[model samples]
Target: MVAALLAAVSVAADPATTASAGEQGAWFSDPVVVSGQNTAEPGIEVAPDGRLYVNAPAGLLADLPGAASFLWRSDDGGATWVLTPPGLRAAFPGGGDSDVAVDPQGATVYFSDLWVGSSTAAVSDDRGNSWFASPLSGVVIHDRQWLATSGGGVVYLAYNQIPAGVMVSKSVDGGRTFVVHSLAASVLDRSGCVCPPGTMVVEEGTGPAGLADRVGVVYATSTGGVGFARSVDGGLTFAQVTVAPARDGIDTTRAFPVVANAGPGQLVAVWQEVVEGQRTRVQFSGSADWGRSWSDPQVVVDAGTPLFPWVDANGGGKVGVSLYHTDQATLPDAAPDDAVWFERYLESLDGGQTFSPLVTVDPTPVKTGPICTQGAACAQDRELLDFQAVAIDTDGLALLTWARSIDNVADTEIRFARQLTDEATTAAPTLHLHDAVGDAITRPLPWLFRTATWSPTGR
Candidate 1:
């Protein structure tokens, strides 16, 4: 039955909440905004029916006219979102970062973006209301990363071939047909200049089959280091490397590198480093031989770096990381620091060899500019680029979404918290119930029976 449910949870999926059993450092509980509409620049994913597939970036920026961009959906899992009314657009003119995946058993629901000069692609399978501006054969689908789904139809697209760096694409018969492959060059140093938006994953049992589908890729290199790739099928082929490996001191600050394999072979990542004097910490890494090797970093959150981690092992893996903390040396232009912020620590135990001291899925401190535009570089030059992601359902609950800058632009509209599933009675229980038997219920787990088919054994 789908490889027996992906080989029995394959990896990462055991945390009935109740802090899974509490005491990893428990404190999680405070985050709830869900849907959004302050105006343009939104992109989130996580929808097969579990809901939370937002995509509102109404971007009228240079397109002048107005309202043309859309794709808003939030069916409760995201708290309260609804605007499929007449959005979803990308004839090109700023409507970036929108990658959603859902085809584990076939109702079909996938979305992708990246239309700058125009390789022309604005696909959607009815989940976002509507969209279809295809042209991927035009051969220009750079830095894309959706990775997953070997369930039978095939859908694995790990991209980044711009200027020349990173590649792995496959649609099998599912994503509509694709098969691009070009991996390893020490794993991308490709002339340099990446970092517009790059985050990939794939490398557990290795995708398409065996249920270990994880193909990871992260780019933001001035060389600050963050570019790796691995495709266990699904994406077809890949095996690149270049890790900044060496946590504790944290160091990365170029901020933006979040990977997730959760199981199969275990590979979790986090990024945000600017450690010359220390303050931009948010470092965590792992690779159970998938990327060859890694492990020896843990700084959780301090200067913060826009991290988002999720793993609920029905087999044994549970973690959720999200940290922002930015005023950038005192309002380096106020950036995304509208002020009232805090999603802190968050812990649900069961998957930790090093970092595990979180528990604030939503304690609500809230504050960080909602500026949708001022100079816009993901808003005043990347302060953490408005949330964009954090998902986990099937009974674990911890869906997060963010984007509310103050002066940089895109204001008060995209917000979500979820963190449901509790049971910690008290010791300090103001609201720290990371769930153990805390039940909030969010069912939807399929596609893992070791991954369902397609293996090469890392050759």
Candidate 2:
């Protein structure tokens, strides 16, 4: 099935001819500005029809003060965007974090917002022209509600309500109602900062894990390192599987799990953790038989500390992970106020076996600050909401969005970038030194002999 899908629209890049130099250098489009200022916690969704929706809790200059959330809609991919009215805040008092999801069948858009201690969502059937907002029935989602929609319009939301365990909710009738299920009995600590929220997805078909048509969820636990749950019978019943065992007496909030279905039955999950008391690293695990079991966790990237790791998988065997790594050599000073942070992305074409070198998405470190200012000096803190977002289209183009300070640390703004999955073209190949090893290294070179061309999958 994966082969069939890839073969259907696969393009054989011209073998690096002299005339193909410019096209070969076009592996990725230049950074496209998604929003100008005053927005954080950017949640983006790309519809099957090529529409783009980005949502944030607050800070959008276009939105009123009481407006709970701000939305930006783009019809021609991400080239141009317009603000959707601030109706979401009218539904919830005092804004919190929010995320967006879309139903492919009807182009129905679902936007979930956390506010005033409860999680609520809005639905848009006619793209972003209009919306219907309401509170989720089954659970009072306390933290970030990461929503995922199945092809059949089945919406799954995963959240963490401290002292009540991590929960997964299902909404079959669009975003109108929900059925919540508890995957864990208790969180690591009700008082500790909210453990990073869990992530959920409905398998496309029989998953690589051998579980056909199952709804799977992966979450971070205070007591347990990482937990997995799946409902083979839709959203009715669920059983747990151990992905990563808990570290004795260690806080698990540092380990936020992000899961995605790569292809037919293939699953990939990534997160971050504080290991050996001082070092922090991004951990990855995969399941080929659904959520029943998982492979041993492995470190994918490590700097001084990696945070807010986000993961997404393409229908082909490609997986992309994005996170920011900061170098903090001293304790207590762990969250460096003047640190040079690398907003990096790593890609894997053959599942998780190997990953491309860290790809810096931001032109410069967050330390470079803002290019413009909106309000008072932006608070010098690790802020970008909970996590950034990444999505891949049928054409194998990866769209990534994140919030960053505009001028050093003056204002917040949302940024977007595109990367080609099949291959990244370059006028010519480049070189790099071996890390500490003297031998030069060059493998998996996609641009050496080929250039990527577009072929609509008609997905």
List the candidates' TM-scores in order.
0.28, 0.78
Can you tell me which runs of candidate 1 are displaced by over 4 Å?
A: 1-41, 44-98, 101-109, 112-154, 157-171, 176-198, 201-216, 219-227, 231-240, 243-248, 251-255, 258-271, 281-402, 405-411, 414-459
The top-ranked prediction according to lDDT is 2
Please give the RMSD to the true structure for each candidate, in Å: 21.3, 7.8
Q: What overall lDDT, based on C-alpha atoms, would model 2 receive against the true structure? A: 0.61
CA lDDT for candidate 1: 0.45
lDDT of 2 by residue, 136-211 (tens): 5336636666777775656777776654765667676777777545453245422233454567777644343222
Report lDDT (Cα) of residue 355, candidate 2: 52
Off by over 4 Å in 2: 1-27, 59-66, 179-185, 188-196, 204-213, 248-252, 327-338, 368-380, 407-410, 420-443, 447-459
Q: Once all C-alphas are superposed, what RMSD does model 2 give against the true structure?
A: 7.8
